[model samples]
Target: MNLFRLDASILPGNSASAQLADAAEAEWTAAHPQGTVTRRHLGTDPLPADAWALATTASFTPEADRSPEQREALALATALAEELRSADTAILAVPLYNYGVSQHFKTWADLVIAGSDNPTEPLLKSTPTVLATTLGGGYGPGTPREGWDHSTPYLERLLGDIWQAELTVVKRELTLAATNPAMESLRPLAEDHHTQALTAAREAGRALAGI
Candidate 1:
């Protein structure tokens, strides 16, 4: 079994999303002791800026007429595609930024989603995806900005559209400790959510591992 951990947190140790991802990885490791796990920290090692340029160029360029720059660009896209293709399960940790995913996460998504001619093949097919997200304010299934919850919804759509993969979302909202005293007092609540998310991730991993 193979698992890929994509961490998109930008705030170093202070990132709640990254914490959840770590917990998820730990849970998965414990559940499947024999499985192989690979970690990709987009916050630290981001995709090259030329990824977009390569994608765009590849879209129009013929194989024989491609320039060296175009080839490098295609190579990067292919590399990201191969990573996703090789993984049986993927764990994505994304923190909400203004009700949306961080740019780092979006770039990673772009790389994975761009290489496929169908836009969904590389992401949704047989792979299972677990999404862990943290939000500064409360907004979920029925909330006001729920429609605008660019992180969860977009992820669900992308995974479903591309790979037909089953997706499980574990979201923690209203986590701005400074602004919301109630949120600040909900450390236990957040911890509970984290635990639940890890449990869910483990179950997802086990299922994917055929255990």
Candidate 2:
């Protein structure tokens, strides 16, 4: 089996999202000891900001008139799309930043769409995918920040609806409780969220392996 993993945490060393992804990945590895993993860490090695723009422009330009930069961008975009198209399964560890998806991930997604053979077609049709996400504050119904999380819904639409993947999300909120004095009272709930997310991640991983 081939597994594709993507990490988007700016703080890789102390990332809550990565923690859950680790649990899921560990289970997948245990099941498929001989499987190959393709890894990409956007935080450490981000894609070029202009690549998507160049690629999109190239699509409209005739092949013979494409510039060197455009050609390179197109190649990078195609490679990114191929990663999803070729993967048997995938795991994405993305954290909410500023109440929405990070620019790094948005760029990646745009490039993938620009590079696809058919933009309307789902690249990961029926593929099993695990999405591990974390939030620093609580966004549940009674919280002040309720309905403020703009990240998870976008992820679901892009990966599940657009890519047509069978996606399972493992989410942990209130991650800042341990560090922020203002959120000290939420520590207990944060711990609980952490534990539940880990369990869900492992279960998602096991299901991916079985698929």
Candidate 3:
């Protein structure tokens, strides 16, 4: 079982999103002790800003007329898509940054789609996917920030709507409560949410691997 794990978090070891992802990945690694896992730290190794542009241009231009840079961009996009193509499962760990999806992640997704759009492709056709996310605050109905979370739902659209992956999501909210003085009162709730998210992530990883 090939596992393609991608994490897009600028906070490094301090990222709550990474913690949930680590929990899930731990279960996956245990279940696939002999299976290979590919890791992409997208925040640190973001795709070039022009990757999507070059990829799209290369797709439209004749092979004979493609520039060397355009050809390289296409190749890079293909390699990125191949990570998903070769994987049986994936963990896409993302964080809600300023109430929106990570720029690095958006760029990566666009480039992958540009390079791989065939409906018959294996990767975009029901590969099991786990979306791990962390949000700085609560966004439940009636909450002050009810409509603030845009990243998690965007990921849902990309994986389920666009890519057609069988998806599961595990997220931890109020992540800033632990570190922000203004949110101190919510710290206990944050801890509870973290525990629950980790538990769900572990269970999802194990169950999906079994299937």
Candidate 4:
């Protein structure tokens, strides 16, 4: 089995999202000892800014009239698409920024998800996907903050549409509130939801790997 791990955290070090992704990778490696792991760090190595422009041009340009820029863009897009298509399982470490996935992730999403009008040419067809998200606040399906949760549902819908994959979301939120000693002392009843979520995520990773 081959796993593609995408790390989207913008932070340089000790990022919660990156840590979670590493945890998931570790679990997967443990389960599939011989499996190869491919890592892509979007924060450190971003796609070129003109990638979209080149893709759009290539989409419209005739083969004979296509410029070098357009050719390069199309080539890049094709490479990215091929990588995603070849992966057996994909683990995305998504950190919520302003209630949504980071812009870098969104750009990567655009590159991978082929948006053609043809119904048969969907981007990722039946690829397994796992989304691990870290947020400053807690929000989920039916909670009061659900309306503000732009990350999970949007990603779920997008990935489902493209890949037709089984989507699972493991969220860790409000770590500061949950782990702070002073807050724990003052609010003894405060739920350690972040820790629970992390534990759940680790188990989920193992389960996904069929361990």
Candidate 5:
């Protein structure tokens, strides 16, 4: 079996999203002790900012006239697409930043599309996928920031709709409550969210492993 893992947390050491993702991945690894895992850390080694554009334009330019940079970018896009195509299962750890998906992740998603054999095709095609996401503030129903979360929706559309993965999302909100003085009153809720997310992550992982 093959598993693909992608992490986009800029603060790896102290990331709430990573914590949840770890819980999920642990279950998967435990189930598939001998499975091959492919890993990508966008936070630490981001794709070139211009690679997506280059690859996109390269498709329009004839192969013979394409520049070296364009060819390289296109190759990278193909590789990214293949990672999803070949994975038996996948875990994506993406955090809500500034109320939306991070720039690096957006770039990665775009490049994957640009590299796909058919841009509109579903690369994952029902592959099981676990998405662990965290938010510093609450954005659930009736909260002050209700509907403020732009990240999770986009992720769902990409992994579930666009890629057509069998998706499971484990979300932890109010992650900043313990540290942000203004959110002290919400600490209890934050802790509860954290615990719930971890539990959900583990369940999602086991399911992803088909156990």
Candidate 6:
């Protein structure tokens, strides 16, 4: 099985999203000891700033009439699409940035969702995908910041709504509770949430391995 993994957490060692993703990847590796895994660090190697605009323009222009610039743009999008098309299973690790999606993730996801110039072929295929996300604050219903997680809804639209991929979301919330003095009272709960998230991630990883 081929596994494609995307990491979008800017925080390196301290990123909860990355941590959970690592756990998931480990499980996949264990199950498929000889399988190949492709890793893309969106936080560090983001899609070029101009990639989306170029690709969008390319999508509209006829292949014969498209300029070299447009062709170049379309190629990038095709490459991203191929990654998803070729993968048997994929993992997307995204940390909620400022209560919303990361700019890097948005750019890459946009290109991946936007297909190549071919009208007949779909851009992204439905692959089993694991979404590992982290929220610095709690956003569950009845919480102070309820309904504040803008990232989750948009991600659902992209992975579940747009790509039609089988998705399992493993999230760790209240990551800042243990460190932020203001949220000290919630530290115990935060620890529990972290433990649960790790277990879920590992289980999801193992399950994906079987698929």
lDDT of 1 at 150: 74
Give the C-alpha miss distance for residue 182 in model 6, angstroms: 1.3
Model 1: per-residue Cα lDDT over 15-132, one tens digit each: 8777666666666677788989878888888888768667767768888888887788777777777777888787888888977887777777777666666565745466777777
lDDT of model 2 at position 63: 99
> Each candidate's root-mean-square deviation in Å?
2.8, 0.9, 1.6, 3.2, 0.7, 2.1
The residue pairs found clashing in candidate 6 are: none
- The deviation in Å at residue 27 for candidate 4 is 1.6
TM-score, prediction 5 = 0.99
Off by over 4 Å in 4: 114-124, 140-146, 176-191
Worst 10 residues of 3 by lDDT: 117-126
* Cα shift from native, residue 183, model 6 (Å): 1.3
CA error at residue 161 for candidate 5, angstroms: 0.8
Candidates in order have lDDT scores of 0.73, 0.93, 0.85, 0.72, 0.93, 0.86
Task: Write one digit per residue (lDDT tens) for candidate 6, span 1-211.
Answer: 8999999988776788999999999999998999999889987777788888888887878899988877887788888888887889989999999999988888887777555444334334567788999999999989999999999998877787667678899999999998899999999999999999999999999988984
Report the alpha-carbon TM-score of model 4 versus the true structure: 0.84
Give a tens-digit lDDT track for model 4, residues 1-211.
9888888888848677776667777788888999987778888998887776776668778988999988888777777777766788778888889988888888777766432433234455666667887876657566567789788778887777656666667777764555666545423322466566677678768866877
Instruction: Compose the digit string of candidate 3's lDDT tens values, residues 1-211.
Output: 8888999999787878888888888888888889988999987787899888998889999999999999999999889888888888888889999899877888898888777865334465678888999898999788899998998888888788877888999988998888899999889988999889989999988866873
In model 3, the Cα lDDT at residue 139 comes to: 92
lDDT of 2 at 94: 97
Report the C-alpha lDDT of model 2 over 155-178, residue by residue, as the tens digit: 999999999998999999999999
List clashing residue pairs in candidate 3: none
TM-scores of all candidate predictions against the true structure: 0.83, 0.98, 0.95, 0.84, 0.99, 0.92
Compared with the true structure, the alpha-carbon lDDT of candidate 3 equals 0.85
Can you list the residue pairs that collide in candidate 1?
120-162, 124-162, 124-163, 124-164, 125-163
Model 5: which residue pairs collide? none
Name the lDDT of candidate 4: 0.72
